[model samples]
Target: MLTLIELVGIFFFAVSGSLMAARRGFDMLGSAFLGGVTGLGGGVVRDLILNQSPATFAHPVYFLPPVLAALCVYAFTPAVQKLHRLVQIFDAAGLGLFCMTGTMKALENDVNPVTAVLLGVITGVGGGMLRDVISNVTPDLFNPRDVYALPAILGATATAFAWHFDVLNIAVGTGIAGLTFVLRLASIRFGWSVPLAAGHWHRQPNIPNHGDGPRRNF
Candidate 1:
């Protein structure tokens, strides 16, 4: 079940990446590359930080989902275009699952709970960050448009709490993921946003505020 969750999460992340690629008028190769990066980048970073082989490299089967996602987007462009608005939802789901997987892996490695939570949030958002960077867009992780990291933080905290209580089973993990997913979607649905920096730091007279420009989807 955990393996299945990871695959599904990877697929969700791949969908977001491929969809973004398609939106940017990228070709098949671009779509495939971005999809694979979004699907496996986070876990690879987590593994590397933990001084282990990336799971995607060790289990080549994990490559299938991202490839499949790219193909789907390539072949079904029109359908995908219509559902593009759901990209955030797809990302949210992946964020939830990845956080759980990361936290569990960290705990398995006997990391302290705080480190586990930090790693969990990193695993949740790292792939998306890489995707945005590669695509030359601002990462959603830093976007002030919505409550992004909060959900992952909450989810990771929940997972750590569960682990502390020795009840970190499949059901609890799934529930925590679901909670994160719902929180993310709800934030989007309600146009929820976190407070931006509050100081009246003055920009240079000639310096333009990019924040006032059109908001680009990451």
Candidate 2:
């Protein structure tokens, strides 16, 4: 059950990474590198923190999907970039699956519910962050306060709560992941977003203008 979810996530994430590379005009090698990192990086971090072997390292077959995804993108070229919406859908799927899997694994290792949810969020966003960093862009989840991480965290927390109550079987996990996926897709379709913080640099001070001052033109 665990490997099944992980494989689905790996495939989705790999495709997302390849699509990004395609959009950015990266070469075959670059696309492969990005795909591999995006597909495996988060799971590797989660496994190491849990004191277990990374799936990609332990099962060599786990590495094949990303490589295949990258090659497909490279072969398709600009045509693949035309279907940009497909990328977003797949990315959401990846986020949902990865977050749940991460949370479940953490709980299996006897981690507290809070920590498990945190790990879930990490697994959900970590790959995209690494992908953006390598591609010379700010991570979208943090810089702009996107709805990405929030949905993942919400789903993870729900799953954790269920697990705490001893009701978190594979079915419940899948449902939680599905909820996250739907929310993510809805966010994209409806232009939903989290409000940005009022940074000091962006705040405008209210200054009183005396009658002596000329009124500003609209």
Candidate 3:
């Protein structure tokens, strides 16, 4: 289930990246390159942290899907535009699924709870981060107003906790994945975010007199 979800996510992200590349008037090779990176970048990072070769490199079929997705997007731009909401839904689903999968994989490798959560967050956000870096934009996850990375953190943490408590058997893991999926989708629909102080600042205290020489104060 997790593998299938990741594949679905990869296809949509690849298509989205390819469309963006097309908008930039890139040639076929450029489009394929962008699509492939957007699709597989997260998995590659997860594998490297786990001290293993990337699954995409070992299984060449991993490359085919993204390339094909790019071609389809290039050939059917208008149709894709018409289904933009559907694409967003797929992307959200993929995000949740990948977070869960990364957490599970980390646990299987005997990673501690904190490391599992970190890996899960990395797996969830790494591809999009790479995509934004390639596109020369600041990542949306870093924006205080965006709801991207929070959902992944919430999902990953939940999975780690479940594993730690031995509450996530195969059936329970599926449920946890479902829970993460719902949380992410709700965040999308509701524009959820961590509360922040808007237009507020705290003044720093001055340091006491040190000596005859002038001193710097924090």
Instruction: Report the alpha-carbon TM-score of model 1 versus the true structure.
Output: 0.87
**Model 2 score (lDDT):** 0.83
User: All predictions: root-mean-square deviation over Cα?
Assistant: 5.8, 4.9, 6.3
By summed lDDT, which 10 consecutive residues of candidate 1 come out lowest?
199-208
- Residue 43, model 3: Cα distance from true site in angstroms: 1.2
lDDT digits (tens) for residues 55-106 of candidate 1: 8988888999999999988787665556557568788989999999898889
Per-residue error (Å), model 1, residue 190 = 1.6
Q: Each candidate's lDDT (Cα)?
A: 0.87, 0.83, 0.75
Q: Which ten residues in a row have the lowest lDDT in candidate 3?
A: 79-88
Candidates ranked by TM-score: 1, 2, 3
- Which tens-of-lDDT digit does each residue in 1-218 have in candidate 3? 65665677678667756765665567888888987887788889999999999888897878886889778977777653544454445455656767888898889899988999999888878877776678776665776656788778888898898888888776776676677667766876877777565433554457677687877656
Q: What TM-score does each of the candidates earn?
A: 0.87, 0.85, 0.76
What C-alpha lDDT, on a 0 to 100 scale, does residue 174 get in candidate 1? 85
The lDDT-based order of candidates, best leading, equals 1, 2, 3
Model 3, 12: alpha-carbon shift in Å? 3.3
